[model samples]
Target: MIAIVSAPTNLGLRPPQPGAVPGTAKAPEALREAGLHARLLGEGATDAGAILPGRYVDHPNRSRNAVRNHEAIVDHARRLAARLVTLTREGRAPLVLGGDCSLLIAAGLASRVARPSGLVHVDGHTDFRHPSNSPEIGALAGEDLAAAVGLHLPEIADIDGLGPYFDRAATAHIGCRRDDEHLDELADTIGLVLPADRVVMHGAARAAADVLELPALDRGFWLQIDVDVMDPQYMPAVDSPDVGGLSPDELIRLLGLLAPRAWGASVTVFDPDLDPTGRHARTIAEIVATGLRDLGRDLAL
Candidate 1:
């Protein structure tokens, strides 16, 4: 069975304004309100409720030495991982509804509980920022990939002594744009680094086929989908929407090909506040439901 777990946390992002909070924390419920829950439920999926996060606080004057809401993020990740472990033990493939890319920490932690796991990260930007690559470092949502691969501070990176959640050789990053600053480093670290142009040239199906060849897939892999992977024209309702990205159709095809094979998956970074008309939520709901409709086929639920 495909179980839906909500991780509504914006603890990883910088505040858009001095006093206001990032609207991404409401993503899970926004998606559900768009009928995602109903569509999945009608298809026999189970609701695993939510793993609520601590309050979002942006201390602009705080030191850049650590991530914002550091304690909250770690606490939330542990709880989320525990929930995922239970669901996976029940033979359920979790479809995590995320608040931002920072949720990848939980996914990475959970994946290692059973056995070594791989990661397929699909996002517009590399999200690979780290102290070595940049001087300024605070928001985790912008540097989740780095944190997951153990390239960040040891605090969140080595939660419960389980650091480097996904082995560098077992990770694949797709959909990053050509101009992404960390592409060179990512190419050297990740098992496979396919930018948007390469994915377009090879085609979505071919891209997925290439990922399936990874040795990590032999054990299983987790899929991380950041909706900003779609073109800004198609999906501008995110924390950071770049100009050059894949089309909705391309993303749907890519996900449809990869979703079924993944042990579980996370969809993140869709800000409903920017989508007042609810059009974007509806689009995301469709993309996620249609793409992940066959999740956990091996269990035959």
Candidate 2:
């Protein structure tokens, strides 16, 4: 069984950010329509924050604000952590649907309660910049990957027991682009860096295969697919769209390939509101639905 958690909070971000559409987290609904029994963290009807925080840049990018979002980040993380642990203990996969990229923290920490896990990052931006060098030092979403991997502000890094939740050497970030110069440094620190070229030339299938070919490949896998990995023309509602990205066909193929190996796969398509035509939403829904279906065959948690 798969338990779905919807985090409809964009509060973990700095300004000039794009997040999952407000009142339009149709991903889980689509998943249910496709015959999956999914549940939102707080409520299934609409966006709510108990376990989820609303969108805002309450935390400073670094030292630029009053108080960092320490309390809020920890509070949210703590709640999600408990829920995720419960799911893991029950031997179920949590298909986390998010309001922003910051939700990665929950997924990372929760995976720790069970067997150690590896990550498959599929996105345009590396999502691994520090507050200091970030284009906008006022956002949590941007700093999320760093925080998960034992970086970022003290609160996030010192998350009580979850500090080492992120094993940098176990994570594989694929589909990184040149625009994300900030991420290049962080990616190098992790394990192997799979550039956009590899994702483009080889497709996510070949690239993911190559990633699994590495030493950490056999570990329990957690997949992160940022929708910006799709072209803007086809996926206009992304927080940041790289000029060169993988096609829908490529994405579907990659998901099909990865589904067989996912212990828990959580995807975030930030800035879904920026999608003007809802063309991107439909596209996202279709592809994700197909991917989950494939996973149903053997998707363990």
Candidate 3:
């Protein structure tokens, strides 16, 4: 059985400009409207309900919103982790739908509770910024990987006093743009990274195979996809859209190869507000359904 959980928190995004509407917070519902739940067989579904974020605020010394919303993010992470722990303990795979990439903190924390876990991070950007090196630190979503590995951001890194959610050697990052900020540094920490160019050159199936061969395969892993990992031409509904990315078909192929090995998975950073035509939402639903079907089949075995 697969449990679909909704985590709608946008405190991680750079605070919306004066009149800008927040679209990611609406992603879970938009995906449902596009038939994700029904296609996945709603019988096993569990709505973990949304965790709304507090208003974004700035600080003089720390990252804007990062310091102000620190407590709130931690609270939400704890609650979300608890729900994931329950589902995993019962042998149900979790399909977490997100409001932004920050949910990784929660998911990574939850994975550690079950056992030592690895992460397969599929995204357009590295999302591994450290406050000491970051010129501006307003968004937690951008620093998720750093926190996950206990690299920086103490408040987020030290969730429940359990830091370094995933062992550095056990994690693998795929589909990130080659020119991402600090790409070299993040590679050093993540250990296994298949950049966009590599995925395109080697093909998604081969890239997925290499990721699976990385350390910690036996310890279980979380498969995370930020929709922006798909090319902007195919998925233009993200806050930060890099030029080069995987095609939808390529992403689907990679997901099919990785799903059977993942204990849980998450789809994040898809902003429905940008996709006025709803095309992106429907595409996301198809990708998730296809991946979860494979995951369910693997679990059945």
**Top candidate (lDDT):** 1
Off by over 4 Å in 2: 16-50, 54-62, 65-68, 131-136, 294-301
Residue lDDT tens for model 3, 157-226: 8887888888888888998887887788988777698898899888988998898887666566888899
Candidate 1 per-residue C-alpha lDDT over 1-301 given as tens digits, one digit per residue, 9 for 90 to 100: 7899998888998888879899998899999999999999999999999999998878767786789999999999999999998888888999999899898999888877854588999999899999888988999999999999999999978898898999999999999999999999999998999999887787999998999888866666788999999888999999898877888888889989888778899999999999999999999999999988877674332
- Number of backbone collisions per candidate, in order? 0, 11, 0
Worst 10 residues of 3 by lDDT: 292-301
Looking at candidate 1, what is the lDDT of residue 283? 94
List runs of model 1 lying over 4 Å from the truth: 299-301
TM per candidate comes to: 0.97, 0.82, 0.93
lDDT order of candidates, top first: 1, 3, 2
Please, what are the lDDT tens digits per residue for candidate 2 over residues 1-301?
4566766555555445243223324444443443334222222222222356533444324466322355666677777777777776766666666666667777777767665777777777787766656444445666777777776766675576667666888877877776677656866678767777777886667786777776775765777777777777676666666777778888888887886677666667545456544555567666765664434235454
Model 3 global lDDT (CA atoms, 0 to 1)? 0.81
- The TM-score obtained by model 3 is 0.93
